[model samples]
Target: MNFSQIAQLLVLGMAPLGAGSYALCRAKARPERFGGAKFHSPSWYYGWYGFLWAFLPPLLLAVASWILRLAGLRPAPDWVLMALAMGLGLAGLVYAHRSVNPELRARNSVEGVIHWTLRMSSVLSILITVGIVSSVLFEALQFFSQVSLWEFLTGTSWSPGTAFLGAAGRETEGVAKPLFGSVPLFAGTFLITAISLLVAVPIGLFAAIFLSEYASLPMRRIFKPALEILAGIPSVVYGFFAAITVSPWVVNTAQALGVRADYTNALSPGLVMGVMIIPFVSSLSDDVLNAVPMSMREGSYALGATTSETIRRVLLPAALPGIVAAVLLAFSRAVGETMIVVMAAGLRPNLTWNPLEGVTTVTVRIVDALVGDQAFDSLETLSAFGLGLVLLVFTLILNVISAYIIRRFRQKYE
Candidate 1:
């Protein structure tokens, strides 16, 4: 059946499920005089039990049919499949209603179903992650077959212009060979990330301190939400603000100081990205600071410490681990950011320390390589996956470190 027809059938199917639930619930909730023993579970458990029975049959059928289709075999006609699904659903509903009685452990049955569902979800997520890693690794191997891993990792140049011709089996010996040295890309990525952290960390940490330790409740409520609202703004919008507003301002300011700066300087995107990452640091840091035991603060105060002294001596140390984790998480976020860098930071793979010079990140280059008309098997195209693998590894390391730090912090605090 078509989408609307299938939707209507599914919606109609829910009617019976809802009716069965309400009927079974009301029946189970009757006075004890009507039954021998107390009801094993609440009335809602029966309702949910019936609902699951009504829903699961059709969903499983649909999934089975989809899998069959993917295997290049048609199991049945759409109408026949729909009929079978509905038939099984109705049968399940009838069976559920018949099974629901005073002696039946409805809660145990429902909880078992829920537990398995959660377990299956976890397994599915792991499978998806494995699949992604496998695909990227396989493609990266293809790219590395043509480009040396050592050169890709250690070389500084990143020109892949002639790689497409090489992929198409053309001679490219005399012409300039494609270089896939990822050092410049990684360097740019780190430079921008570092600049962003410089802008975000201090401001975010100070904001968190004010909100958690110093601000009044009324001011905290207003300012915290306002600060978080910055995170809600889209990256593209931030990129636009950086490009249109921040970039030119940086250029003009640099010129005023007798320093030459590119319009697409690294500093502008870094500053803008830092603003974007402030919420990640501030929100988590504030929570960590607040979670510090009140007794620590009181004890510090009793020791004749001023508020600043108490914060520095007691609260800061207490929350340091969590704050570090927040900063690391924010750094990971800054590393992976694409649009802000794409728009504000020019796509020049410049290996330099100057923030005023234009630089491109791994993400931007990945986007550039994929968006072109180059063949998929081209070294340039496959290079995206190689870059992706590096990015993924870096991100995973940061996450692992963050998790370890948080675990250590919790063990100490809790």
Candidate 2:
């Protein structure tokens, strides 16, 4: 059979083997005299052992088959090899289970292997993260090689089109700076984030306070998960709402204030993003606020401090570090957001301070540049990497600083 077919058979083979292994392991652990030693684990542990034996060997063999293909040693379809490997592994496990004594220490040895397998699974996730970071770094390095570090960093103009033309062509007209500067993008990110925070923080914090400090247990049970429902709403829905409904309302509201406003401006998206993040901020803030020593709040209240005073002065200060961390986390989420900005914010990269005007963000540009099929070597494509790297560095710095602040605050409290 073809490779894919074999692969499918292998996957199908694994299911029965895994179930059979578990059954065999449980049977082996039954109180029956067989081979010499006594089983050290419970029936379930043996079952887990059987599953590990059935799954791990075939997985390893499939990996080996892939490597062989990469090395031009394709002998049989990968699926066939995988199925064969799994069948063999299952046979070995069954033989071992039937022959081994229920009271034997073999179960312990199998359990050990199962534990190692579980730990190894985590490497898949870590390796994927490392792969992404490595790719971004490599592409960013390539971009820097073509564009001088100073021009890319310090130059107010960010027109990457000049980088597309070779030195021969650039000698006549010089590099035409991209009309879209990153500052506006950065500013737009901050403006939207700031507005979102303004909208979310107070509402989220108050909700958190009500839930944690004032709400009845029944009310908390009902409200907490309801608040989390906000987070569960798909971001794309938020984008559509901002783009279709919120933008027009914002424009009309600005007109009422005797100011012109673009329909697709930063305000609408920022407001929607704020609504999205409120649950995040509230949930985290609530946890932090609740973590404050009850005695502290009681002491303030006993001293005749009102609820608001105690919340503002005692609970808030106590929770400041965690709240700051939460805010920074929310800010990072906002900054990295793409859909809301892409759908609601206009694509025109104007270096304007006015949130009422049409402006673009770094994330929007990154999407625009990389969305369609294009040659990877082109400047337009490479510019996405450059912008991504800058964004990565910015977020990393903020995270580091926020972590430092949180740690220092913890130390003070301790």
Candidate 3:
């Protein structure tokens, strides 16, 4: 049987053990025990105390067995593991039931268990993040071993058409040089991201400024949710809109203006992606703007400052940090978007500044590599990890810059 089935059986066994132990403990906490002596904790705590003791040991043993098996050590069969967990759980339940009495600190024990459970859950979240980073780094290391970091980062060409699964199969291709250069992919990704930000930041920020400073209570109530509705709409719908509606419009508009444009231009997806990210910037900026102390605005008004000037000088400076953060977040969202780019942007990685032309992004190529009958050990497949690592680093750098800007703004605002 698989690990999940074993876990299900063990959980099923522990449930009965806990119920019986809790019933026994509650019985012991009755008024007849110790001649109606008052208990330190409630009867419920004593019951839960039994429940925790009954479950923890079995859970630990099962986890240990799974870890051992993962480490290439033969632990036991599924039945044996289940039997061991069940036996220990029953033993622990009986002991826990017997140990509970009027003098026992059952409430403290239960509260401590609750606290530790929360602490472990938080730790587990951190560990999961670390594990993901480590796995990506490891795979990227393997990919870089085959392709040099210099070529991957600096070289321009990025076609990894058909890669063999192993070095032994290299002879079939006769020492064929594989180009893993990522400059075009990076260029395309940044081109779309920049266009997305250009469309998102000013429009969203101005919308926030209007909502916070100009709009009345009823207007705020109506417009805020209406604007946020943009965020809730599915990306696939946006992708279809970009492909069908926005792409053609762009092509025709450019043609009417006597310029050439492609059907799958970068501008279409970037514009749609920007519309999707607008609510993020607007919502966060609105919150930050509203949080800027009302007294500051009132003081500026007392000094005969107009609303526009006060907003420009006082509110914007105070709220610059959060606004920067929101813009950076929108930029990241645009860079990481997949469906819209796949639907509206071309697959060809074009390294040009013109948004009128078609371009592909890192996410598009990553999806391209893994969607087909790609070999697990192939160069194309492994390049996805390398792309992911580069994206991770780029995101980290953006976060660092945001943090620095936030800190500097806070120093001045405070």
In terms of lDDT, model 1 sits at 0.88
Local accuracy of candidate 2 as per-residue lDDT tens digits, 1-414? 445744664567766777888787777676654444455666677676677677667766776777777787876865467658867776767765765455556667776776786888888789987898889989988877776666665555556555445422445265565433467667777888888888888889889899988999999999999999999898899999999999999999999999999987989998999999998789999999888888888899999999999998888878989888788867877877788887888787666677787777788878877874556676667778888888888888888888898877762442
lDDT tens digits, residue span 1-414, model 1: 445545666678755665675576546554464456678788788878887887788877777777777778888898898889888877877778777778778899989999999999999999999999999999999988888989999999999999899779999879898899999999999999999999999999999999999999999999999999999999999999999999999999999999999998899999999999999999999999999999888888998999999889888888988898889979978988999988988899999989999999998999999999999999999999999998898788878877887677653643
Is 2 or 3 the stronger prediction by lDDT?
3
lDDT of all predictions:
0.88, 0.77, 0.88
RMSD of each: 2.1, 3.5, 3.6
Q: Candidate 3 — which pairs collide? A: none
Report how far off residue 95 is in candidate 2 (Å).
4.2
What TM-score, over all chains together, does every model reach? 0.94, 0.86, 0.83
Q: Which candidate is the best by TM-score?
A: 1
Among all windows of 10 consecutive residues in model 1, the one with the lowest summed lDDT is 26-35
Per-prediction tally of clashes? 0, 10, 0
Better of 1 and 2 by TM-score: 1
Candidate 2 RMSD to the correct structure: 3.5
Question: After aligning candidate 3 to the native by TM-score, how far in Å is the CA of 4 from where it should be?
Answer: 4.3
Regions of model 3 farther than 4 Å from truth: 1-47, 65-97, 101-103, 162-176, 293-306, 411-414
Candidate 3 lDDT by residue in tens digits, 244-334: 9999999999999999999989999999998999998999999999999888999999999999999999999999999998998898888
